[model samples]
Target: MENSINVSSEVGTLKRLLIHSPDSGLGKVVPSKAQDWLFEDIVHLDTMRRHEYDYYVKTLLYFLDTEKIKGKLNEIDGDESRNFYKPDHPDYFNSEKVIELQKLLADILEDNLTKMKLIAAICAIEHEWYTTHDELLSLSPNELAKTLISGTTPGNEMLFPPIPNFIFTRDIGITINNHLLLNKPAKLARTREALLSQYIFYNHPMFAEIRKNLIEIPDNETLFLLPEEEAESNQSTLEGGDVMMVAKNHLLIGISERTSIYAAKQVIKVLFEKKVLDKITLIKIPKKRDYMHIDTVFTQVKRNMWVILGTLAKPHSESEDEVLIRSGLLKSKKSEKVHLVQFRRGQENEPRVIESLEELLTEISVYDLNCSPLEVQFIYSGNNEFPFGAREQWTDSCNLLAIKEGVVIGYDRNDKTLEAFKEAGFEAVKVADLLQDFEAGRRSPETIQNTFILLPSAELSRARGGSHCMSMPIFRENFE
Candidate 1:
């Protein structure tokens, strides 16, 4: 059997994680195209590639596989080898298959040397990206990986913008309680992430046996299409950043600027049908770039403790609640306004409406969490102030990556938020300090507890993502 995923809690000990190295994609962005790709400012490709992302990759390699698959290009390069193997042979493929593979390589690859090297590397991974049966078996694995990371397309003369956000792999898809939810990205800039992630989960040999258990959302476009139709503005669109697993049987999905309420309903419907989720909590935040996804403003860092934005941590007033009710944003038993039509198999049932968002969540937790009551102590970003809190949040003060029950990582520039964590009993330790301790043989990561290991923020923070935004945990032990 292949390695399986089992993430049940945010703070569980992380065993396996998925990450993407920064590539030529970052260089593809120019000043005029920066904002369109969700970049706040243009970045120097050399600085981004050489400095900012190196430590992040080093940190992840400490916990996950870091080896590169070497290929056999020299032996397989000649036209004779390409034309030799047939379907009946163990190696799989014949002359026609080799021709198609050669054509594909020529269309996407710029030089003969790079094309041969990539083909060799792909041969090592033993997977194929094909248009047909013979074609699939003919191409090598290195070619597929190169195509995914380099943003090259077959038959397209014009180069597309490399997906720089691909470095932030956390936004693509999420594994919830052993089931992989292949998400549909809300932006064209991030569509490649979804496709590549699904390909890895479904076709990679590492997940070959466990692929049967994955539940990929079927509506997303997998292949790039030029002059594509505009996505229905009102239709459902989901992103992994908006989904959170709060408990073993409980999930919290944000219906915010990036994720639509329709998207939340679609995910909720699938969860209910699978019987894996007992209750689903939907949080509605302001629709804006600053609060694009829930993880940007909210994440659980430890048991009974969450990092949240100051404005959202506060409860609503009676008058404010009443206004929401009247506006049809908040429903009640007296006014059961229907907005979502629930579907089972191919049949549709009566519309599902909530009495009140807060009420629904509170009532559900009362049973699922038992007497502990699922009370989460929130540590808000900055103090209770206007622009100060907003400024800190914009820099990702609330985006924290939880390594284990008590260890977490975030940007060091968020001083105010770091102080808040210190006040809440989490000791603040700089990455330099932690690295020094390990180097001197005084301590290792396992020996640290209830500590916030701060990472340098000069370049990474400028990209508008913290540690949590960059990593996607694949296997976390159950905390309970």
Candidate 2:
């Protein structure tokens, strides 16, 4: 049951897609301290999950013979009741709940440590669960360094950190011409999602099947980005939330709140090693408190085209600490690394740098592409002051869901963003009222490309990731 989206085509039908239906995992959040819990607002987890299921999962399930939870591990690895170990995991055996969870997994999996890695896998799933009052109080210097990466202990006064808002299979990993460059999240809060994605991609039968293409390639043929490059992070530094898959061969990397220019560079290097993308176009999303991903700006509209929220149409300006480029690398948005790269290794590759959203679109031939076969478009975001207009742009209005070909679903908050679609002669459907932005994160394309997991849990709503940001489509309908 492997799924794929055909690239190099004009506009492919979304023949099959992956979706994560929300679940009880969200009930873990404490609403009163929503923001502290990585949530912008509050919603009933049970009802919210149900709502997303209807909007994303059930709506498209019949359209696809979606792959359910991978039963391969259940039969072999036993994630629920299996007991695994990670001697170097740093946090294993730290919490009572984790210990209990381990036992539960062991009972369910019934495998020896050598055979099972369930404990580590579950810890990887529970990103915030590792941060506890006890764990925080007793941080050694090493753990302290890791905690500092997360900035500071949140003021939520809760037992566990919030799970990832969503790990839509589509967002975290995808087929880079067959081999999947599964992203290892730069942010610890979202690390669990990466772990889950890793599990789904590697342990699951379908993704595992496709992996052969990756390993079978020639050794010097190209390795994609090395995993070591992805290891660099500032802790609370960034998440996959900000990344955007634009052209079939390019990645639109946004250096904003959660994602840094340096981190993006590192990620790109990994992709290059794997031959994932031909190049990565770095886009500077406004570093506001609200908008976390580039997805808050745009997504696929029709075949060979995109529907972008207008705010990102502007260009980049020098930040306070910015410095002049020195040839090898240029000034980064926030981190110490250079934003424009001459020879950086990872996420930073080819910098088709631009200052404004309009410039970026022009460089990508977005206007011309839209007119021809692609039909790419752009619309303004927010009322008057978009990120380009306003000092702050977060509601994630830019993230959109491409329904049928050029047809799309998106947030209503920034109605202006829809102008691009209209201008391009594409139909845009407003889903604000009926399709709530269940998670504070508004990025669409969250669902898995061709599965039926439903939004992993209440976390998607809590983390503010929309369907787009949550998913990473391995396969898509070819639209040549």
Candidate 3:
């Protein structure tokens, strides 16, 4: 099968994606190191997998590759070892459409040269394990792949810290119209992820044809000569969460906590030079952990609809006293402000400034999507209600993944958000129920429209990511 890559829009019919299931590494997250691994709290790995993420896999299979999962649901569920989900196992459902990151890693490691290089590279970073290089090389490709990701041997001996955040595969790389832009993670904990991703995209046979199109943001060479504080400000760091290929000719890059302005600048320059995109919008959001990435604050539900955090949605009218205070701007909080700037390919100097998030999204809908102003819609987090808005946003109510236009997957715990969806004339259904309906021929992925498929999120929410952050759509059916 050819590994064709093209993602023009977020809400396009998702045909292929990269996902990593919750592995033993997730179970290894200790309370003290939970935050270090980018998790809000340690989750019950079994519950997160069987109850939450397993449904995600099944849903994707049903939509993208029905033959792999349609009639075999019973046999898959009956397996106590869950070998079907394990990439290394013979019984694994290795669907090309619903690809697994670990499976790809294992595939690449099958070559002795690649395996040796990866093991050496990883051992070099994890200095303590440098002596075990020979031991790792002796292991099979599958074992080595698992050991590299989970940082444990077959006997469960810890060689290094597990990459618990690996479950969020969207951060590894992003596909933008036949091109793959690799990520440069901001956190030290995600260093291994970046390295592993680099190797996978560059060496994996599946991505061989598009290797030339793989864009890696170059670092600002002069930063080293500057003072520590100055260098920090100009550092080039970008994660996949900050980048979105919203339209065929337009891309959105967020300057947030995980993505740097310098990196965004690099992207604009490279992309324009290569003519990958004609317009690039740089959205600078508050550099707070609460909104780590722009996707965490908002995501497209359809060509004409979006779900955004209410606080950042629309600008409020100011009183005469407030207007006067704004002249001095002494009391205004910088952290709460959002700034948007759009740069066209030729007119880079005279970039257009957007006033608010709503205006920018509205423009995309109206201009790019060819939607009328009256047709556009905005659904606020927690139905825009106070306390609930902030509470639900914290749990990623805005971060939803659209399997198709108007059909999104979100957390079931966000009741207020579901109510908002219902108010907007969307049917809300649980994933478990949806799967059963699919099996019974009562409903199908194609038949579902204007719906919210809610996943069990008791443990998944603790990871601070929704279905959007968990998925990296490599291919989507063109909206046009």
Go through the candidates in order and give each one's C-alpha lDDT.
Answer: 0.61, 0.43, 0.89
Query: Judged by TM-score, which candidate is best?
Result: 3
Among the numbered candidates, top lDDT falls to 3
- Residue-wise C-alpha lDDT for candidate 2, range 395-479, written one tens digit per residue: 4445555544554444333344444335545444333321232122232334313111123224234455555654444455543
Q: Write the per-residue lDDT of candidate 3 for residues 320-380, one digit (tens) a residue.
A: 3376367763255554778999999999999999999999999999999889999999999
**Model 3 ranges with Cα > 4 A deviation:** 317-332
Error of 3 at 334 (Å): 1.5
Determine which window of 10 residues in candidate 3 has minimal summed lDDT. Answer: 315-324
Listed per candidate, the RMSD to the true structure in angstroms reads 11.2, 12.5, 2.5
Query: Candidate 1: where is the Cα deviation over 4 Å?
Result: 63-144, 152-158, 218-233, 318-376
**Candidate 2: 10-residue stretch with minimal lDDT:** 96-105
Evaluated against the true structure, the overall lDDT of model 3 is: 0.89
Task: Please state the error at residue 111 of candidate 2 in Å.
Answer: 8.1
Better of 2 and 3 by lDDT: 3
Q: How well does model 2 score by local distance difference test?
A: 0.43
